[model samples]
Target: MTHHPTQSPQFFLTAPSPCPYIEGQFERKVFTHLVGDKAPEMNDLLTQGGFRRSQNIAYRPACETCRACVSVRIIADEFKPSKNMKRILRRNADLIGAMHDAEPTTEQYSLFRTYLDARHRKGGMSDMTVLDYAMMVEDTHVDTKIIEYRRRGPDSFITGKGQGELIAVALTDKMADGLSMVYSYYNPELEDRSLGTFLILDHIARARAAGHPHVYLGYWVEGSRKMAYKVRFGPQEHLGPKGWDRFDTEAV
Candidate 1:
């Protein structure tokens, strides 16, 4: 009898830590590594199961006492920008996003540092060094891409690329069902352009143009003001014990 090795992944639980979203609450997680040749397939399966990727690891909140973190995915094809969203898009009209292989660069790291210092100074990733940033972008085994947003140049229409200053950056994962926005940062000084909202809108458009049905936005923690903006995108779905279902913000 011939024996073939099993390729099942092993999951481990993280020790409880202070929740970053909701104060006075603790958070734990179940995680597994995303390595080897089967990483892409495994990533897709895990993502659908409510796990989010960070570099080579896929994790989801697993607190025994709380279930506030819910997985969210925008229904890309069905999404329609609201009046304010339309205004944000118009405000960022001069910026263009060009996607490329997930390779880190000094320019990206600089922008990343500025964003962290200005907005997320107390967040978990606030102390990441340049090497850490590179690993975050290049350590993934699954299909990933880095999108660099820049001001549109005069020749942008012909080149299909942007130029002059890296205004924003997004690290995304291309899953079978949708594009997952793993991480994103932008020029905090460009508050007038509303670059953060524009990135999400741009991803929705990209997903729709590619014929994808969803755009994964990771977790939306209930009662977390920081995550309130996620629910503003209509026609979204939330993963629950019963599976993915329509999320009606009005009913919340």
Candidate 2:
């Protein structure tokens, strides 16, 4: 078969590895480097087609037998907080999330370590060093940012920054269509605050304010308890064989 060069990008597949979300299943991925002049545009196109970015590479699951990993993006403008989610918002009212340029800090890495140890101690990223974390935050070529959440300070309203201890952080990418939440970590000690859910809630608000219609939440596997929370932020669309399709809460 003659291969036609339809574009500048080249794709490659990864060797199968143990699936992190599901036990006993192996997962493979198709990926391409995201760089140079067309990085932003290509990132946007691939993301809409179910690909997610990690550092400078964009990848999506390409397992032969399993298709449980489904891409989900929230309809920012239409999301309504449930009673429990509203309570989470109230619990974290003292916290403020300020957006900053894609920069890494020792303080951020410290919290990242703590979170990984507490929540994902056995996961692949649990052993990431400070330098590894830095690359994860700063290696992107597209428009990216870090949102730091902290207690509201006296001058927070004017400066749009908080002053107390860092409670959470979200590494996000700004696409032409929406914000893609690359990764997020929070103070694992504050389990009562539900910071993970709070972060998503905040992202929805941020995307709506920026006039973006969606907030990409990465892959949501149906049978994985770890991914069940994603379905709560409804009026979301799932990428499928026919393209993006509406996901009904009842159907899930």
Candidate 3:
């Protein structure tokens, strides 16, 4: 007879810290390590249960008083880009994103540093060094990928790869039912291109092409100006006590 071992993940609670999203609120997270052969399956289950992945850790808010952080996922198949979103697409028509293995490169680290320095100077990840960035990209146990965005070259159609400077990058995970966007960063100088919005739209298109039903966008914290853009992706589902439910931004 053959014997197989079952993988069980042990969970831990984080010490409370000042919330980055809401004022006068504290944040705590319940997290578990994601490793070994069954990591992909475990990631899918935890993501569906409102957990977000960071490197090898899967965490969800466990605050005592605040229930403002809500998990959100885009309905990829039924998504229709609004006029502004269409304009963003048109504005960035010259770019193409090529999916690659989750390997860290110095080029990517340089871009990441510039982005953090310019945009998130005071954020938690502001102090990340090259080693830290490399670990973020490489320390994964699931089906993870990095999509590098650049200007479409003349031979882009033949090679399916872009050329010149790297414009943006997305670190994502492939799940059983959907694609979960772990993190993404772009060149801050190209603000006019609305690269952030373009990244989400491109992911929606990618999810649809891959026959995935949803594109997980992490948490949407209520009353956080920084998270308000997430709601613009309409017809998305928000995980609540009763499970995932359709959220109408207009009605709120």
Best by lDDT: 3
Colliding pairs, model 3: none
CA RMSD (A), model 1: 3.1
Off by over 4 Å in 2: 1-7
Q: Which stretches of candidate 3 lie over 4 Å from their true place?
A: 1-6
Q: How many angstroms is residue 163 displaced in model 2 relative to the true structure, after the best TM-score fit?
A: 0.6
TM-score of each: 0.96, 0.96, 0.97
* Models sorted by TM-score, best on top: 3, 1, 2
What is candidate 2's lDDT per residue for 1-252, written digit by digit as tens? 534233588999999999998889999999998887789899999999999999989999999989999999999999999999999999999999999899999999999999999999998898899999999999988999999999999999899999978899999999999899999999999999999999999999999999999999999999799999999998999999999999996576
Tens-digit per-residue lDDT, 1-252, candidate 3: 432233878889999999999989999999998887888899999999999999988999999999999999999999999999999999999999999899999999999999999999999999999999999999898999999999999999998889999999999999989899999999999999999999999999999999999999999987788999999998899999999999997675
Comparison by TM-score, 2 against 3, better one: 3
lDDT of each: 0.92, 0.93, 0.94
Where is model 2 poorest over a 10-residue stretch in terms of lDDT? 1-10
Judged by lDDT against the true structure, how good is candidate 3? 0.94
Ranking by lDDT: 3, 2, 1
For candidate 1, which ten residues in a row score worst on lDDT? 1-10
Worst 10 residues of 3 by lDDT: 1-10
